[model samples]
Target: MPTHHIVSAFDEELKYLANRIAAMGGHAERMVDQAVFALVNSDHGLARQVVANDEFLDIGQREIDEKAIVIIARRQPMADDLREIIGAIRISGDLERVGDLGKNIAKRVVAVTEARQPVRLFRGIESLAELALTQLKDVLDTYASRSIDRIGFVRDRDDQIDAMYTSLFRELLTYMMEDPRNITACTHLLFCAKNIERIGDHATNIAETVYYIVTGAQMPAERPKEDKSHKVTAQATAAADPS
Candidate 1:
């Protein structure tokens, strides 16, 4: 009887951790959306609000960590319980980083506003955010449901986000090269785009953690990576231009 009671208490503790993680996930997703919206619309007020709201995620993480440590010390969980606690810590950390990424984008709103950029660039950035935020929301749903069916699709979509980011990277470089005056705006947009791409990355990391939580195995080490921005160099572009 006492053993069953202890197990019940442990389960309750795990549930608490899961609930905290879900709250953090939802808050982080909203932050990403608002940050992108602020950047695209040049809404300085909304951007400032996002920068201020990051404290919620930080506080949530600290709370989860503190609870997990107490549970670990008291319960000595094994197998799935251990995975759940560990995964909660990891997921919370990723969500916190997502919040930071969102904050980073918000911080750049003012910088990107210094030079006048075309609407197309902002649209391009918005499209990338849409995809990334979709990935994030889907993965969070998968985590909540523990549905294996949704996991693969979420993981696979990371490549799509990477490809889109690469396309944007190329287009931004072209604009900067075409007009030196656009450099300031395009450069800030580039960093913002990178932050959106990283939000996709954190979503992918959460997908892997979800997989681990549901299954005991780690995901395959080699996931497909399509971001080729590093190879886009002046010399490389010139060499490829066989005029």
Candidate 2:
């Protein structure tokens, strides 16, 4: 016979943790979207707001972690209960990283606000950001609904973001090569693109965490990567000087 009172208290604690993580996920999604919008529109005010909002996500993650730890110590959960606690901890950490990446993109937007940037560059970045934000929103929805079946779908979509990023990287590099004046803005955009790509990765991490919580199994393996930035860079260097 399980202790009804203790189990009830533990259930409440777990629910609280889940709610906190969901809130953090929401903040992260908004921040990422706002940061990218600021970049595309050169809106420094929005970028600054995104930067400020990241502190809230940091606090949320800490609170979730503390609450999860207390639940573990008090309830001494086992099996499925233990998985739930650990999953919350892992998801919150991923959410925090997502916040940080969004913050990075926001910072870049601020840095490039005064610089002369090409509209095509902004277009490329906007496209990449759109895909990343979609993945983030889908994964968060999946987590909230506790729908494990959608985990693989979200996981598979990350590669699309990676491929988009790789394409943007090459396009930016070509712009820099064509005109040295474009280097400063292109460099900042490159960083912003990388940050957005990383946000997609964090979303994938959360998806895997959800999978673990549901199935009690580690994700099969690292998803096959489609990011070819390094290879493209190497090829560009070799073509520049064949000796």
* Model 1: per-residue Cα lDDT over 55-134, one tens digit each: 99999999999999999999888888888899999999999999999999999999887666679889889999999999
Off by over 4 Å in 2: 1-6, 234-243
Clashes of each: 0, 0
TM-score of predicted structure 2: 0.92
Top candidate by lDDT: 1
Model 2 error, position 138 (Å): 1.2
Q: Candidate 1, which segments miss by more than 4 Å at Cα? A: 1-7, 235-243
lDDT of 2 by residue, 18-90 (tens): 8898899899999999999988888999999999999999999899889988888887888878888899899
- TM-score, structure 1 vs. true: 0.92
